[model samples]
Target: METFDETDRRILSVLQREADIALEELGARVGLSRNACWRRVRALETRGVITGRVALLDPAKLGFGLMVFIQVHAARHDAEWLEKFGRAVREMPEILGVYRMTGDLDYLIRARVADVADYDKLYQRLIRKVELNDVSASFVMEELKDALALPL
Candidate 1:
């Protein structure tokens, strides 16, 4: 693992919140020269500490207001089944994230769509590609906390 000092941590924390902040402005906020800040940022990127930056858009404004969490139970827990399932999930635009889980749930999928109809369409498409033992969905009523930034 790559080790970082205090300055690197400060830069990461600031950039996580405001990735579009100008180099000079970021440097000023973090108490560093613009050139120095740029070098550190580049180094962080090289070390895989900083991945990619993106604009976080509001789902409601974008017409993808409905968010649903799906618990999936696989019919067959084999390499071929997992591969096909992975491909199906990756190709679906509505599926934001999918994670292999422990306990009763085999997989957890997070998705966003326009409404119930859209969600049903997504569900149909998913079942067509892979065989699932059980599939259960829970709609998100309220999102109290959602922070993409990891603590430095």
Candidate 2:
């Protein structure tokens, strides 16, 4: 892992929330010159500290109001089963995130859809691809807090 100084942390903390901010302005915000900021950002990119920037979209505004968290128990814990499961989940656009867990649940899947019906379709598609021992879903009625920014 690459070690980052306080300046890098400040730069990253600011950039996380305002990815498209102009370098000159970003430099001012982070207390650095424009060229210095550019160089640091370039180094960050090269070291994989900064990944690609993307627009954050509202699921509700896009007609996808339902957010579901699925707890999946795998039928098999072998490498082949893991690969198949990963591939299956990765192919589904509705699935926003997939996480392997250390608890009773083998995997946790976060998905957004238009409604329960859309989620049903996604569930059907998921099961068709891989055999799961058990699948439990929780629908999110309200999101208390949702932020992609990491604490510096």
Total backbone clashes of candidate 1, pairs 3 or more residues apart or in separate chains: 0
Clashing pairs in 2: none
State which candidate has the highest lDDT. 1
Question: Lowest lDDT 10-mer window, candidate 1?
Answer: 143-152
Q: Give the TM-score of candidate 1.
A: 0.97
Question: Whole-model lDDT, candidate 2?
Answer: 0.94
Q: Tens-digit lDDT track for model 1 on 1-152? A: 77889999999999999999999999999899999999999999998888899999999999999999999999998999999999999999999999999899999999999988899999999999999999999999999998898878
Runs off by more than 4 Å, candidate 1: none
TM-score for each model: 0.97, 0.97
**Model-by-model lDDT, in order?**
0.95, 0.94
Cα error of candidate 2 at position 93, Å: 0.6
Q: Count the backbone clashes (under 3 Å) in each candidate.
A: 0, 0
TM for candidate 2 is 0.97
